[model samples]
Structure formats: structure tokens, C-alpha cells
Target: MDTVKIRNKDMLWDIAADLHFPPGFDSKKKHPAIISVHPIGSCKEQTSGNVYGEALAKAGFVVLVFDASFQGASGGEPRFIEDPAQRVEDIRRVTDYLVTLPYVDEARIGTIGVCGGGTYAINAAMTERRIKAVVSITGVNFGRLSREAFSGYNPLGALEAMAQQRTSEARGGEVRVDNYLPCSVEAGRKAGLTDIDVLEATDYYRSPRGEKPHGATSGLFSHRAAAIGWDAFYLAEVLLTQPLLVVIGDKPGGFGAYRDGQEIYGRAASKQKELVVVEGASHYDLYDKPEPVAEALEKVVPFFTKHL
Candidate 1:
């Protein structure tokens, strides 16, 4: 396998990398392609994306993974924006890059998104006609999903406070950032703190499982910008015409999250939608664990082989 950097003039970022797989000696045809997108605040070195890219590449598919704009080596102003809309464009931009390569079979291009990337992939696939298939791992439905709004605060009061925050930000004020991962959950701690979220996500981002200190960030979005766009369940309502695959954990009932995927799948114009729930798996297990990772990829490769 080989890796190379791609300069995207559209996003004005030179932060994309493509991994190439050598075709078997008997085959002289262009190889299939897959793009793996990392989760929010994550770079291409992430375990979830790296394994998927390298594994797919060795399977004779060209895999490209990259850091989103403003994070890692990518160029962008005001780092750590964590803008959902921009991330979808990043994935679409990758598709734009892949089709230009001589070794890539343009017709056989698909995408795999893990966690936050799952939503971006779904959205991009909904908008971009070039994608034939897609897979989302533990994807979050940001727009519709009931989020932890500064707990105990009145909804109306919170909105009023947010209004003031926005007013301040509009006047050239710095945005307030929130760190979901606190290393430890403190006694009588901050509202909306959950051990499950902090522990699991922090383990991956802070440890070798998917660690990359070079390109790490946290919640830096303007409360106003994020709130204004909250209604757009991120391509959730958009109809997808391509065959789609969704993988999620089955044990201990994390399936509630899959409801977002189901909602989208139900609305899909395509007849080839599927959902697979892996046994004894959690959302984060697929991040690095080899057994589960292999199992998940086995399902994804065939989908691309037949479609991309």
C-alpha cells in the first residue's frame, strides 16, 4: 500500500491522504475506492478510520482518509470549529479528489464513516450523486437527537441566555468552549456530564487506540451557529438513492441511537438499505478492537465490491 497527500483547492486545504492497494498481477483494471472519514475533532490517524482504510486498501481497494479542515494538518481559520456542515463538505471533497486518480474506478467509489463521520457520510451521499454505497458506524443524528442542553436550566431561559451569548459573539467576542472529556467525573460535577461519553470517547482520543495529539480539538462551535442549524437533522430528512449499510452495537441496548439511521433508511428512495447489530458490542468497540473491527469490515467490503 502507498500513501500520498492531496491539495484541495476548493476547501483551500492540503490535508487529504489516499492509500493505494496493488491490484493482483492478473488484473490490470482500476481498483475500487473507499473513503474513510474520522469522527468530530479527530484526524485521519484515528484507529477507526486508519484500520478501515488500510484494511480496504489491502483488499485491493484504494482507500483515502483525511483530516477535516481546521483540524490536524488541514488549513482553515479559527481552528476547532467542529462545524457539522463543513465536515459533510470535507467528505464530498474527498470524493471529488478520488475520482480524479487514474487507479481509482470512479464508478466503484463508496464511503465509510464512524461515529460523527457517519452523519456526514449520510449527508454527502444524499447530496452527491457519485456515491453508490455508504456505511455509518454508531452515527449520531445531531439535529433531531435530544442533546444535553445545560441541564436544569429552563428551555426558554437557556434560549434567552444563548441569545445574549450570540449577541456577544457577534460583537467580536470569543466563543466559549466545552470539554466533554474531563479525565474524571468530579463530585457534584457539571451538569450534563456522563461517564459513558467521557470515558469511552476520551479513551480513544487520549490513548493509542485512536490517539493523535497532532490534530485534536474539542467543542469550539459558537452556541449561536450550532443552535441556528440544529433543525437540519443533517441529511436525516434527505432521501438517499444509493445502497446504504449501517452497523451498530446490539448488547446492553445502545440501539436507541440506531433510530436515527432507521429514520433515514426508511426515507431512502433506494431499496438496498440494511442495518447490522453486532453482538456484545458498544459504540466505541469498533474504534480499535481487532475482532470487532474485522467483523465490521467484512460486511462493508462486499457492499462496496458489488456497488462501487
Candidate 2:
């Protein structure tokens, strides 16, 4: 594995990435490649690289796991921003870099997105034809999740607040950031956030189980408006024509990864698509739990093998 930096074309930021080569990798021969995208509030080292990226490389494919711009080790100002449009563009820019590599088979390039990264991957693949195959694992559509977060209450009220905050920051106000999950499981329980997914996310992200210095579970509040307005499956029925694989947990949490997986699987116009629901798994279970991760990769490795 080699640590590399990719230049984002639009923003000119350096996207920090880890390039993993397969065992006995040969530079003189072409090999299929996979771009493993980390979840929102997470970095390449957490799951995308340390888990799936490494596994996929051992399975005979080159894998590129990257930290999205503004998060992790990537170069960007106003750190921790999670702009949906920029996240989608990050995937495309990664593809741009991959295609330039002499050992990469550009036509066989594929992508795997975990949690919110799944949504971004699907969104990116809609217009980025270079991604021939897509795999979404426990993917959440942030737009729908945000709009319906509080039992369909006044979702726009937060949007209004975010808009105001963006303006304030533009005028030199202190930028505000918030944690994606509770700082700890006990804290989440105390805050009445007892959802299994919520608690597990806190445990995974906030504890040593999955914590990395760069995998900070925070995001700029002002930038959330972009995710609120973006839809991962928008026009997917017409434009998402590549072979797609969706691996999701059976448990439907407040984040709606399971629901979004089903919705996209039904909505995509892909001639070849499959949805694998891992029973007894929650949203966070697919993130790093051995059993669920193994199950997900069992399906994923074969799908990429056949498609990419």
C-alpha cells in the first residue's frame, strides 16, 4: 500500500488516498481497480481502507481508498465540511486519477461506498460513466434522511438555521462544527438516542474500536444544507445504467440505510442489479463487525469479480 495525494480538479485540493496493490501485482499488466469511499464523518483508514480496501486488494484487485476533501488528511479549507456535490465530485476526480495510471484498466474500474459514502458513490456513478460497477453497503441517502429525520417534522427549520450559519461564516463568524454521533455510548444513551444504530455508531466511531485520529466524527454545520438539498437517487432510474450491487443490513434505523438501499435497488435502471440483505445486522454492523463485514464482502468480491 502506498500513500498518495490526488488533486481535485475543481477545488484544487489534495485528496489523501491509499493505493493498495494486489499480491504479486504486476505493473506491466493491466488490472481492475476499485475506489473504496469512506462514510461521512469517517476517513480512509477506518473502514474503506483498513477493512474493505485491504480485503479487495488481497482478492486480486487494486484498491484506492481516499479521504474526501475537507475531511481526514485531505487538503481543503474550512475543514470538516460535508458538501454532497463536492463529495460526488471527489469520486469523479479519483476516477480521473485512476485512469491515468498505466497499470489500471480504466474500463474495468469500479466503486464501493460504505454508509453515506454509498450514496455519494451512486450519485457520482450516475454521470461518471467511467465507474462501470458500483457497490453500496448500508448506504444512506442523506437528503431523505435529513428531510425525514424527526418523524417528518419541520425539516426546513434546520435548513434555515444552516443557511444563516453559512452567511455568518462568510462574514467572518466563527465556524461551528458538530459531531456526527455522540461522543460515547453512555453519552448517547443519556441523550435519549437509544436507537441501536445510533449507539453502535457512537461505539464504533468514538471509541478505540474504530477510531483514528483522522476519522473525526465531526462536520461543519454550515455545509449540511448541500446534503439536505441533494438526492442520491435523483434521476437514477434514467442514468444509473451500470451493474449495481447493494448490500444492506436488515435493521432499519433512523438513518434509513436499509430503506435507501431498497429504494435505489428498485429505482435504478441498471440491467443488472442485486440487493443482499444481511439478516441480524444493523447499519453499523456492516461497518466493521466481523460477521457482517465478512458476509457483505462475500457478496461484494464475487460481484466485482463478475462485473469489473
Candidate 3:
């Protein structure tokens, strides 16, 4: 296993990535490689990112993992800004870096996007042709997420409202940001309705799950970005030719995302797309748990072995 910081000069943030591969793994032989992305508000230390990255490495894959811009050690001003467009671009940047390494097999590269990273991976797959096989684990439509959170309904109106809020913030004003936390713990509330969505987000983002709890408060008005993020359906409806895998769980919060991924998979031009749902897993459970995580690794190895 090896670790280093990679510099990215695209979009708002410069990336600092960590990569891991098998000891004495043959670089001359075209080997499978994975670019694993972290969940929203998560850094490279997020268990999902490294756990999966390390898992892939142990399985003989050269895995590259990194902190998303504005989140971890990656460089971006006004940190913790959650922009889907930039996040998607980050994956491509990592892919770009990976392709240049002598040890990497450019033709056999794959990607894994977890949580919000899942959406970014989908967007990257749509825009970046270099990605061969793509994995989306409990992904969501980022555009839909902002829309639902900001307004009760009316997607376009919500986007427009975001623009208005951006304008207001520019004018030296403030907007109430929702961090999704109950003022105090209550027993009956559904998990993750507070500052973030995933049930263990607080643990991963704010607790010691990672090396450092994010310095940025999960929510603050200073976090707004460009309106381009409002645009979803990164690519017009079409079949994605790359082999794709979708993993989800039966957790209450997991169903909707799995369904969304399925809908997109149906439109894929790629003949090799598969969906697997772990019956007892939750959205976060897939992030890091012995049983389901191994199952996820199991699903990917053969697929990449065959496709690559």
C-alpha cells in the first residue's frame, strides 16, 4: 500500500489524493484499477472511501482514493461547498492522473462512487469516456436533493430560489442553512433528518470516524455556489456503453436511490449493468461493514476481471 497527495488544477478545488495497490503488483500486465470517491461532506478518511479502496487493493486492484475538494486536505476556498458538477469533474481529474502512471492500465480503469459520490460518478461516466466500468452505491440525484430540501415542491422554482439566495449572500446577508440536526436527541425521529442525510453522516463527517472531524460546520450560509449545479440529467437520455454496477440496500433511505439508479440503468446503452440489493443493509452499512462490504467487493472483482 502507498499513500501520497495528488494535485488537481481543475474547478474550485485542487485535489489531494491517496493511492493504494498490491505489493509488487505487475505494472506491465494490464491490471484492474479503481478510483474510489467519498460521500458528500466526507474526506479521504471516510471509511467508505478507504475501506473500499483498501478492499480493492487487497483484491489485486490498484486503487486511488482521495479527499473531495472543499472537504478534506484537498484545496478549495470557502470550504465544504457541495457542488455536484465540481465533484464529478474531480473523478475525471483522478482518472487523468491515473492514466499517466506507468503502473496503471488506462484501458482497464474503473470507478466507485459512494453516497453523493455515486451521483458524481454517474455524471463523470456520462461526461468522461475514459471510465470503463462504473459503480454507484446508494446514489441520489443531486439536483433532486437540493430541490427537495429547499422547497416543498417545484424543482425549477427551488433552483431559482437558490440563485436568489446566492444573490442575497453576495449582498452581505445570510440565509438559514439546514444542517439536518435535531436541536436535541429525540427517540422517535428517523435517522439522518438533521444536518446531513445518511444515518451515520454525523459520525463520519463530525465524529472521529475519519482522522479529523471536518473543520467546517456541516451547514452555514457561506456555502452557496454557482447555479449550474441545478442542471441534472448530465447527459440526455441514452444508453451508457460502459459496464456499470449499482449496489443498494433495503434500508428505508436506500430504496429511492436504488430505484433512481435502476431508471438510469434502463436507459444505458451499455449491455452490462447489474443491480444488487443487500437485504439487511442500510445506506451507511454499505459504507463499512464486514459482510456487505465483502459482498460488494465480490460483485466487482469478477465483473472487472471479465470486462477488463
Candidate maximizing TM-score? 2
**Candidate structures ordered by lDDT, highest first:** 2, 3, 1
Candidate 2: which pairs clash? none
Between prediction 1 and prediction 2, which has the larger TM-score? 2
The numbered model that scores best in lDDT is: 2
Clashing pairs in 1: 108-308
Candidate 2, RMSD to the unseen true structure: 1.4
Q: What is the C-alpha lDDT profile of model 1 across 64-136, one tens digit per residue?
A: 8888777776777666766667787777777888888776788888888887777678888887878878888
RMSD per model, one decimal: 3.6, 1.4, 3.6
User: Candidate 3: which stretches are off by over 4 Å?
Assistant: 8-13, 26-30, 154-161, 173-200, 203-212, 215-239
Reference-based lDDT, each prediction:
0.67, 0.91, 0.68
lDDT of 3 by residue, 1-308 (tens): 56666665645546887778776788676667888888765667665446888777777888888877777788876656777776777787888888888878888888887876776777687768888888888776666655565344465665566677778878987655656333223321454354323434445444454435543434433344342345434452573568888888766462246666666666666677898888787776777778987787788777767776
Q: Compared to the true structure, candidate 2 yields what TM-score?
A: 0.97
Error of 1 at 74 (Å): 0.9
Worst 10 residues of 3 by lDDT: 180-189
Per-prediction TM-score: 0.83, 0.97, 0.83
